[model samples]
Target: MATGAESGRRLRVGLLGTGGVASKYAALYGEYPRSLLVALHDPFDPGAGELAARFGGRVAASVEDLIASDIDAVVISTPNPLHLAQASAALKAGRHVLLQKPMTVTLAQAEELERVAEDSGKVLALYMNSLDNPVFRDLRRMITEGVLGKVGSINCKLANGMGHVWRNRPANFWRGSRAAVGGGSFAMLACHYLNLAQWLLDQPIIRTTAIGTNLMCDHIEGDDLMSAIVEFAGGELGVIEAAWCVKGEQMSLHGSAGSFAYIDNSVVTMKADSPFIGEAIRYETPGTRVVLDGLLAPAMSDWTNPYNQHRCFVDAMLDGTPVPMPAGKGVQDMRVLDAAYRSSAGAVHVAVHVAIHVADDGAVAEAVA
Candidate 1:
């Protein structure tokens, strides 16, 4: 464990999987001078070699070889099923881990990885990058600053046509396998909003009722359309709708003082009283462009949400600071996801068995059933 003060040299990083997601991280890694991608590993030799060539790193022969290298951290971008084993291996080998979303396909795996991370005394973070979105961060700040004034409800919808493309692909499409990726749209895409809902509301979902179906993209094993209604402990009601059939994105928050809506990543805010004085205002900044700019840039920019997230993770490891998205958060998110799936499968409202208690010191204590 090298502290920022102890080591002025760049932190060496090993990429555990050379998939599409891995390539994105590799590009980001190239942007940070304080971090260097030193090794790449994947079962596919060509994929690993491609990423290594593009990112200026050597291809390791195997996962074992990559973890055994002198890298200080490992970014696990493999499929959901492999997350637990790879992350656990990295942590046990005395290296930090940056695991991709959904953490694992099961709560048991997530819990085990959480425990392993805790025992290792190493940083284990989930790649829930949406939290780093500038609009989301600003919205959270506004709500915290009382601009929203007691949020009562939240609605989020993300419908894209990716399912059409995915279904036509080969049967080996890792995401199409429920056994490999957990759930479908809910797990793959909606889970991001689930995390955002909790983050923006600052509350844990106490109960949830969900309905999911593989209405379209029948070739896939999981649901392509899913909707979940959740009740927060603070009395805030949330509605989340996700589908691979439709094509658009929007989120809105309703509060006592005012309301805010985010459509396609732009924000429109309105206040309670406005005699044409303080009318609704819209801020226009394409979210996709922001993310793309971050990805295309030569250096990491704190202004870009995703890059900022990776930068935070690197800083946490080097400075011995707290991780922005810890493994516990991933576990909790997985619990909500599992509850949604159970609720949908049983055709009933499932009680979220997790109890979140805020201690006097402001530390959160979670007990999951």
Candidate 2:
């Protein structure tokens, strides 16, 4: 571990997958003087070579070879199913991990990895960079400052036409296959909002009823659309919608004294029965400020961007700070997702039964359902 005094030292970083998302992460390494891309690994040799050439890293022959290398951290951008095994191996090898989202496909897998990370005493951060959105940061502040007084409900929707784009394309067909990607649109997309909901509201979803279906795009076995109604422990209602068939994104939060809505890139707030009553204040984040590819791309601005997320992880390793998004949060999100799926399949509302306990050493443990 690099000491806090050795701030000039760079953390040797290895890439576990050379895919599109991995390339994006690699591109941002130059922005942080403390992060160095030292090695790359992928089963696809050609792809690994290509990324290594573009990103200034040597192509390792295998995951084992990469783990055994002198790297302080490994960014696992591999597929959903491989996350558990690769991240576990890296942690056990005494390497900190920066894992891509969804953490793992199932709650069991997430729990097992969490235990491994705890035992290894290495930083295990799930990449949910959407939390870095400035708009979200501002809204969280508003809530904390009581600007949105007594918040009651939140409705969020995220949709894109990607379902149509990948409908019959063989290259993108794997994304639609449940066997390869795990769950459907919810796993691919909704998980982002789910994580955000918990972060912004600072509440855990206690109950959920959901429905998912592949209403379009017959080429894939997974659902193309999903909707869920969830109740938070704090008595807040949340309605979440995610799809690859729609065209835009929107989110709104209702409170007893005020309301906040974020549609596309615009944020509007109205305070009820106050001086701002009937007057909606609006703030528009520039188009460039929006992360076009969501968490998959680098942020154009400096405020709470993906680059900041990476920088924070690097700093935590060197400074002994807490990870921004720990594996425990990922497990909690996955458990909620598990409840959503079970509710959808059983046609009944399912209660989320997971509990997160933080040990004295800052290790996180989850109680089984």
Candidate 3:
């Protein structure tokens, strides 16, 4: 079997949505030389046809039509409720899957998707695009590699003023419905930071104490503000906040040897007393802006950047390499989100357990984390 790159064949891609995030990816796939955006499907979104036209693909009549068409991969950017079904269908149809974040609405659904991916032996990468940033990558490296030795705690906040819009959104708007999106700001946004904090520490989030309320958005069926205290498997503490009623982005890590912090997700500053760095250092990605949208907001304007996750997704598919952002990482984030929701509802702490199994080949084949 010849890899797509080896054979000099562009991988055909089917896009499953045409919303903002989907449009960003469509632009990327249009520019990526190794993958062609060959088709797109979105029953509720009329812009699907326009997106296909702009990206050089045809309008797929339905998801089934898209999967059965001549496409080797599927990019799923649908609502949270539809993720499991759409991804399962695509993977079962012998198409690689690139699923957008917050994996699924429930833990069972996430685990089921993971199982489906495992059995199919197809790529099931998650679109936690921030992992591709050199700043974040360096932060994770510094922490895990002991430059910030034995991080004792992490504090992160990801919020935006989207609740104000959700309050007046039509009932058909999927994001305002709790059942449709699992949760408001937390599920929609927090999963990224939760995954990032865990990735930085290289530890599993083991417990959560949370409080959530619809303090700002009266009509939405989910909490607009949420704050959670989480515990890592290695006893590190995390304070995470996600709100649709506010606007901010920041994260800080405190460790035995030094500390690391970033504000607006652009200016990264770290100080270490270790030999790795005896002084303070600051790093910034120029031309980035503070946007109401999540991390991918900056990348949309420059998708062709070498560090773009879309490039990684295409490269992995063409080269037959491991997924850069595996589904297991998303599963772990979902576990933490699940525990947070449960903890808020119960007004108590909830314990989380993650079962990850490594195959003899050293790949993480299955995980319910």
Candidate 4:
């Protein structure tokens, strides 16, 4: 495969949407050696020009204008509803895409996007900020290595004060529309941890039961406080609680032989048997602290440090490396979110209808069971 690097040229990039999440990723195009931000488009945000000024791109007149320009790829950070149309357009135009979280508002849209991506033969990577975390990598390693014997359950709580932000105002913003975001806290926030839990366990969540309500944020259309208990296909259980009305985070991974607990993904505490560790061990970042006989601590990663997720996307496009987070994985994520929403609506346990399958050629396929 011929690459931009091999041709002694950087891959020209385009950006859609200029919101907070877009800003978080836009800088990498200018910083990474193999990519350059050449065009940008955001109809609702006047700040698009400012983003282009800082990130070395020209703010295009429209999405069509941006995609029609001389760009090889696009980074889409728009609202949930916009995801399908924008991503579909880009893929049809033969441009690689890096899309924001909660891939789409509906499972149908996700499945459609997946089909388009597979047919287009272009890279469609999901931009998940949590995937950059080194902690989860270490945790996955420990679990896979049987350091934590027979993992049984994973409990997570992710909350924030977005309810307060929406309380004083009317339902004016895009986030205030359930038609746009799919759900409230669970869709916007809990989806991240849900994907993470399944990734760590290397299995699909077969069933979920959830309860959610618009407790304090009546201005928002969906749930402000939501909790769900998920059953993995491997029989491991997961407890998830997400709150837009509160502000805090906690995650615990329990195993028959040990357990790991942490808050805000920092200052983790680990407890194991005599062979693994004598007692509880707690520590923070910077240095590589040893846990057992060579297991290092989950040190913090500066995701903006030139070689982050965005760079990985560039490499995948130009160098034919594996996509960091594939579009099929995003479809599975949508299935989990869909199950949670269905379970909450029915007040009963709902089964995730989609299952993941790997092809003989190593491509991922969706099996609707």
lDDT of each: 0.78, 0.78, 0.82, 0.81
After the best TM-score superposition of candidate 2, give how far the Cα of residue 150 lies from its true spot, in angstroms. 0.8
TM-score for each of the candidates:
0.83, 0.82, 0.85, 0.84
Sort by TM-score, top down from the best: 3, 4, 1, 2
* Model 4 CA lDDT for position 141: 73
**In terms of TM-score, how similar is model 4 to the real structure?**
0.84
Tens-digit per-residue lDDT, 110-195, candidate 1: 99999999899888998777765666666777688776678899999988879898767999988889888788888888878888
Taking every candidate in turn, the Cα RMSD to the unseen true structure, in Å, is 12.3, 12.9, 12.8, 12.5
Q: Candidate 1 — what's its lDDT?
A: 0.78
Query: Residue 323 error for model 3, in Å?
Result: 0.5
Candidate 4 per-residue lDDT, tens place, 25-65, comes to 66768667777889888887888788788879898998999
Candidate 2 TM-score, C-alpha based:
0.82
**Candidate 4: C-alpha lDDT:** 0.81
lDDT of 2 by residue, 1-369 (tens): 547546477778998886765666676664466678889887854676766776577888889999999999998888898899999999999999999888888889999999999999988998877765566776777777666688999998888868888855775556777866667888878888899999899999999989998887667767788899999989999999888877788888988766776776554434332322111232333111222222222362242354367777877877777888898899999998889888888885566899999999999999967
lDDT of candidate 2 vs native?
0.78
Question: Which is the better candidate, 2 or 4, if ranked by lDDT?
Answer: 4
lDDT of 2 at 155: 94
Locate the minimum summed-lDDT window of 10 residues in model 2: 286-295
